[model samples]
Target: MKSIKFTVILIFMMSLTTFHAQEVVVVDSTGVAQENNEVLTTSIVKDTIKVPFKRFKAEGVTAVVGDYVVLDSDIDKSYLELQQQGIGVEDITRCQLLGKLLEDKLYAHHAKQDSIVVSEAEITSQVDQQIQYMVSELGSEDKVAKYYRKDNIAELKTELYTVNRTLKLASEMQRAVIEKVEVTPEETSQFFYSIPEEDRPVFSAEVEVAQIVIEPEVNEEARQGVIERLNSIREDIVDNGSSFATKAVLYSKDGTAQKGGLIEGIQRNSPLAKEFKDQAFSLLEGEVSEPFETEFGFHILTVDKIRGQEVDVRHIILFPELSQDVIDAARAEIDDLREKIVNGEITFEEAAKKYSDETETKNNGGQLVNPVTGDTRFDLTKMDPTLSAQVYNLENGEVSKVYNDRDYTGKSKFKILTVTNKYDEHKADYAKDYEKIKALALKEKQIREIEIWQDKKIKETYVNVNEDYLDCDFSSNWIKK
Candidate 1:
């Protein structure tokens, strides 16, 4: 997994597709910390040292954006981070690197001027999470400290905290700039017409699908067995002094199990299931909860630490098994529901409202909301293969055969799909594709706003690019020559 800082940088980079770190000590690919040299040695894995660290470095300043100093090594560090993320930087020139860093600092600098404050708690939580991830990947806390060449984890955390905080400020500032910018209906129509007839974008076929799902029912025996297993695991950890992390690695079914079930930065208002938050916040540090059930499965959680409204925790989840007979029964149930709709005995919407087991869509007549656009339309070309295969050939109002599928947790279920709406491939139309056109217009407007902001800020702010980068082409006026 990439570090939190890399994730932050990646997000910030995406925001600047039309528009677009720190330093101190250097960590080599051999996992050794060394002093600055005239020429840095190359290490294929050196990029894995993901944190932007600062020790007293003799590296020259590459540029100055507002109050932030961009060091020459900072560009190298960003390159290494990109390399570690498996992103090819062979074509990414040093000037481009400096330009991105300059843009980021300007945002962060002005964010401070505008009194935008990133929560210390949030930064601390992220740093801790990053540490935990590195520890999990590198195999130990001592190894993580060594890799980053820090005296201890505290020093590493402090440095990472500063870097992450600034990156976050840049992100927050970008959001603040464009969050309220929206295109009016007239603007959408104008954007649609502005594109020449020959240059208009052709949209792919799309579908709005609805589903009625029936999850296999686990017997009471299986349910109790899972809960009891979790209880036994909890007992061993509490009474036998066994390692919670080891047990999680051995037995947890959750995706975080490899990280010893560690979940960091879980706040009270975090978008987790209610049952989970209730169980998580109820425990004090080092206190293990008794086995409890959530939408995922039965879990026994241990709170590692708590900071104000946030908690870092670990959990082991055990899902109850469904008997083959029970699975068959669910398949039959959905099949019968499909028949009812097919025979016109009951409408798909009515059957979905009355019988569908999927919570997210059941109340909405089983309409699947496109996770990307928060709308019902899904472009088949961009849809997930499994979903696209199911709905690709279905006509409007046509029902699909009952399909066996597994939810995110790998729990077996059966569902019947129906196409609620279908749009054939067509050229952009003001009346037919208003939403898509509106989105494009709004994005163009946001890009314009950012460009204007960047131009104005560069003039007002103190920016000085080193002479080496004076010839490089940048999107904004960073070189005040």
Candidate 2:
């Protein structure tokens, strides 16, 4: 009876572990145990044991997963339910589990080192927004839940939070890896020239841009009044049974205000503005937070959930009042700058350095990058939304009439923008597409660097293997009998 139970458990464990040999023996020359080595797992236990495939219950593996000690057992129908979730396994034993576990640990480490933190309201806000997008794309909320294999909205949100948190960590890791990497013009040219002509790409003529935006000053009294209004709304929601979502839809003034003030999924450590994010993160689920001020305006929030510190929330935002006079003033100043450029009295780069408020991009001529490919040319849609709509109407190098843009601070400001650059969609040329090819080549080079690093890390990592099937060909270097 003892041997039979042992065999059953062993067989289950082996289904997850990579099987290296076709044949099995009671004992091979290396003294490794095998069951009809030449036979598959099913045939190995032909008559000795029969295990039913059903929903798995872990006998003792919960705590071990948290610590990264992988259980030697099936994950498909049982402990992991990978099959149930349709989560494909890459390397059942060696890579997938360890990669996922490492990503979790690394996110924690970076969050601490960088003081990255999240608030409940922020996550709630994110969840609400994601729900909207998913609803739109899938035709309805119910369909989204069905597509995700969730029984309802709550479960679908739970899965989204889990996926988003991991993705945020991965982004942080990639950013860390890429930040210090530098490419020279020579290297760029070399990479560009190396691509086969037929496979070369035509990069959009995108500009790399930077700006320091400032909002017209708001009266302190008016700002305070807005705060008081938000405080009263929040207090009413908390103390009474009033629905926060209903009020948000009616009163919120942000882009997403119409549909219950939900923004898209906001993961922990998301790169949103500092002040607003802080205010968003401080609330608890289903609880209305106190009115908080960000550059955007007075914000009141209600958190929907908190999953691993990534939250989803709904918020009502009211921007501070900027008089029409201030808007005209900003537009006039930008027009003066454009006139100087049109007259050739001052160059765009000089104007950016001397007067353009956007801090990051002024030093060079105002250029924008395609985030998807880091290219200078962009499709019209890639431009700052208000700017994009306006610029698409003008030919290249034309300056626009005075118009308003909502500054990052959430205050309305006006500007006279130029269709400063343009590119035609054409076949890739080494001269025009060099930078694009260079980046791709550099990424491949970095992957090679990572592999070398991985080889060393795995060798030093303490690993052990089952005493049976040691001679089977394994994918990773760490496993030997």
Candidate 3:
């Protein structure tokens, strides 16, 4: 999802909106190892490449908040993958990588200059946890160690953590800018009512609830069995030195297995729902992890390099089956929660913990998140038809009769929903718009502050620009004019 941004930019500055949790790899500006002596080619998948370090290029710029912006997310791999996926375009992918890099450098520089610190200790701790998580996802430490070509799985983690932290700090700075904007009652009311009646959002009674969920415990023996199976397969691959992709097609359980288990050109830290993410990135090239475990089950990993802004990896995921007896026990428990809530013995929130399907929702009282937006609020149209139908009919405190729901794998599961809160549609009132108004107002103030600082910095810094780029269109008149 894209966030609102208002910043002045130079000709070289790029802008990108990333998929959440996708890792945004930052390039080394101080000195990227020089590439082959040949001219950089903008076309072809593997252009006889010999490069010391990765670099990005983009074309067709846009202006955002005075910054010459572009999107250069994945010039090479994105294009090849998109073409495979039936998306054809050159400049589009070209800009994607450039935009990501520009934004990364700009905000990262500001964070360091402002002394927004991410401590060395914090980075090290996060790296350690990440290594363990990778081991878990790969089903064992050895599986991870073999894939990365590193002596061990823990090497260079501090380096990765530092880059990750830099990006994190930039995000916080962006949030600070947007969250502080101040908007008044008049502004909110005017912005809201100014829209046509037909366009005004029809708000149904919407309930916002928080929840914590714990999945049912899978039998330990069953989990161990899966890990053992994976270990044997990994042994076969290693012993024979067989092609990993070829083996993945034959044995990998993930959907991408048929394609040799390769997932490429994806941004870093993207919320690809699986504990395998940490494991996938943990290995250095040519290394593998032994069998490890996660919420999804067991897995083994093979990590490629951090090429350009993306990392390539593959995995075999193994999930254990819960017996019919386990399913019945969980369902019966959830049913009992309904009875207690019906009897007024305890609040639905209370029963959620002591009873109910304790996994995936009880922590926040069985509330479903807006999966698409990660929002609690959903217009009926944006909701799942079956769930929305039930929600519309049920009054507050009403527990839905057991209905069908699908887990990530599209497997059918039984679920009960409760309508905990609702807001009816009405014209926007300033009193009710405090958060939004305050946010907008604060943003405007931040831009003013930054603008003042930027104007002063531009005037004071001893900067020089080559003639061709000096006249290039930019967000601010920061270059020598």
Candidate 4:
């Protein structure tokens, strides 16, 4: 048999706690030996000597769980792949690897016994995403192919499909084990109090700022030009068998272009613009949408697949190019509004309500919310680069000078920011940091629940590890002889 290597690593990250495990299996090629028997032909002329033959010696199993056997070469291959991905092998003990392998086998065994099924489309999509991620990380598809010893992306996808499907099933099983876990308010509070004072995390200096953003309006000609370009691209895709994904990589302005314009696992009821969502969900699989306008820009999308309410799609987005005159007009308007606010002719909130083009913030009087914490507070260091630089020295209630910046979608806008509130760095407190503490507590509880489930499953499953790995330090029980 030809030797092959495989490696698997599962990582879980939580605040103050993380788990990392790696499994490697290396298989050795089978070897055949032949022995020839020589008889004393001079002494026995009538007798013929019979020779016995020996069969090839097969490679030893690296790990075993029930009917599953992990070969050594698979382990070695896994380690090599992990090294290519920049994961260090020096710290991972052989026993740890063996334990992880046993755990994976156990999960796979149980998954099969439970009749857990993963769809082919899901596996294909996940493989594509994994390939895209590796390509991006390794700098190019050719590099990825070389690293994986594959001829191309298609061969790599075929190789990884089974692995991706197994991992998905394991993840689903883990979620099932922990889905019903809940942390009560008392438990959360207690978990918070258990942290020693000196060990408590320190909060960073934070600021709450508000803004009135005014996007420069493109001229009719510019808008029509963008729309026509998108239409032509769409036509090329439909008529010429041109790859929408390849075109998206070349032409899409969005950050996901590196991923072939794929936006994975977006819910149908997501907070995306209504027009965009409607058009996105209305397309059939492999169907491309015509040019459609949203708050961001004109977009053309092809639905790759849909699972329930979640959709995966590739899109090409084009934004209308604005001229200096259009931008100057927006700047002048924002400057006028800022002057009115500074002169007390209109309150900052009132001006924002009346003129801000951004609907999410305008209705709320332009108050900025931290997407992470879902609050109107942000660590000054965490603020948008442009906004932070503009408001760095501005005192509370001070209005910044008008400045041009791009919004989340990379659309140019002019804005005047005001630092409404600032909080000095301090130690975490039960009152101010309740939400943060509760989230940490919930994560801890989930981790604990998963651990408990894992322990129980290990006891119920058949696990066996080679004696060679017995002396290595292992994090789990995989040596049940």
What's the count of clashing pairs in each model shown?
1, 33, 62, 18
Candidate topping lDDT: 1
List candidate 2 stretches off by more than 4 Å: 1-225, 234-249, 255-270, 277-292, 300-315, 323-398, 405-412, 419-434, 446-481
**In lDDT terms, how accurate is model 1?**
0.77
Report the C-alpha displacement of residue 346, candidate 3, in angstroms. Answer: 3.6
lDDT per model, in order?
Answer: 0.77, 0.52, 0.52, 0.69
Higher-ranked by lDDT: 1 or 3 = 1
Task: Rank candidates, lDDT, best first.
Answer: 1, 4, 3, 2
TM-score of every model? Answer: 0.77, 0.49, 0.51, 0.68
lDDT of 4 at 328: 86
Give the per-residue lDDT of model 2 (tens digit) for 1-481: 1112221222223322211111210110111112332211111132222333332223233112111333323222122333223434332432333333333333334444455544434445455666776677669877766655467778767755643443344345434544566777787777666667776675554433333233355678678878888877887788787888888988888776686876544565677666656755776667777777764567887777766646667888886665677766766677777778778898666776777665455555555455666555656545668656666767666655656676554667555555566666667676666665666666655544444433444464444444432442333343523
RMSD of candidates 1 onward, in order = 7.3, 13.6, 12.6, 12.2
TM-score of 3: 0.51
Q: Identify the leading candidate in terms of TM-score.
A: 1
Where in model 4 is the C-alpha error above 4 Å?
1-10, 14-61, 64-126, 129-146, 150-153, 218-225, 228-290, 299-317, 343-347, 380-394, 407-410
Tens digits of per-residue lDDT for model 3 on 1-481?
Answer: 0122323331112222221122222222111112342213243232222332344433322222122232232234333333444444443423333333344444555665667754443344345555555566668766655443345545445444655565555555454444545556676556555556565443444555433232344677667787788888788778878777887898777777766777654445556645676676667887778888775557787876666555677777766666777667656665666566678887878766655444666666666677655556666655667667767777767776765555765333555667777767664444664444444444445555555644554454433333323333334453536
Q: State how far residue 12 of model 2 sits from its true place (Å).
A: 34
Q: What is the lDDT, from 0 to 100, of the residue 156 in candidate 3?
A: 40
